[model samples]
Target: MKEFIDYLLKFGDLNEQQISCITANAVETELRKDAYFAEAGKVVRQTGFMTEGILRNYYYNSKGEEITKYFVEENNVVICKASFDNEIPATSYLQAVTDCRLIIFPKKNWEEISGTVMIWDSLMQKIISRALVRKVERISPLVSQDATTRYLEFLEHYPGLANRVPLSYIASYLGITQQSLSRIRKNIR
Candidate 1:
């Protein structure tokens, strides 16, 4: 819980009162590997603060294959924002790739806490900004770079993702075929 609070503080300068409110209604849970934190077609009830382990956010393609969208590592927030915000069914899935230690807080609780805690509002803004920046980055090189170059850039940004996630998932995220990804890796090596 201290670690989760520390992470929140890193996003903004938070006072003790705000920190107290943030931690007040939170609950900690241990998620085993392969657990579904948030699933497609289900409304997200809680947003998680990952103290440890890896999580993947993905969506299904028309063919029903799961295509990885993003990976959240330790000290990151894991949520399906659209589902959480609107209380609607999710289009994406959130899953634990490793056994995880997480702090979970319901959206209702977060709203109540943030309503009183000004720092929490700032924290949410910062998080949104970061997500936007990452979206820009992911799309930019796809327009300007070759597939091999894009693959290299992906490695640069997510150093261990290729090794951590399955090859098919990584390939789908790269917008390339698994065979192409393998070729790119060979060329890079």
Candidate 2:
């Protein structure tokens, strides 16, 4: 809990009481592998911090294939920001890739905290900025690179995600077929 508070403090200084309230009041949950943190069409009422394990955000296409959008590892914040920010039904699914421990807060609680705490407002702003940066970085390959080049860039960005996540999922995240990814791997070697 102190660790969580310390991370929050980086955005802005918070009163000790505010920090205590945020930590003590937030819900702590544990989820098993394949469990969903949130799903499409559900109203996402909570925002969370991933304290352990891995999670992924994905959406399904008309054909029912999952398209991976973002993966969050331990110590990162995990929220469907589009739903959370707009108070609408979620368009993406949030799933646990491994057994996970999470600290979560209701959207109402988040709103109340931001109203009274400058630190909370600053934290929200920082999160929004980071999300935008991540989206821009994800689009870089489409403009300047071919499939093989994009595969290399993916490795450069994530280093060892191939070992950590399923190859098919990584391929989907890269917007390429698994066969194409296999060909790229052979070409690299």
lDDT of each: 0.83, 0.81
Give the Å error, residue 42, model 1.
1.0
TM-score of each: 0.89, 0.87
- The worst-scoring run of ten residues by lDDT in candidate 1 lies at 161-170
TM-score of 1: 0.89
lDDT of 2 by residue, 1-189 (tens): 655677676677788788766866688889899999989998888888888888888999999998988677776787888788887999988888878898888887787777766667677779668767976797677458888888787787767666777878778888889999999988899
User: Model 2 Cα displacement at 37 (Å)?
Assistant: 1.2
lDDT of 1 at 10: 73
Candidate 1 lDDT over 5-27, as tens digits, reads 78777778878877788888788
Instruction: Using TM-score, give the best candidate's number.
Output: 1
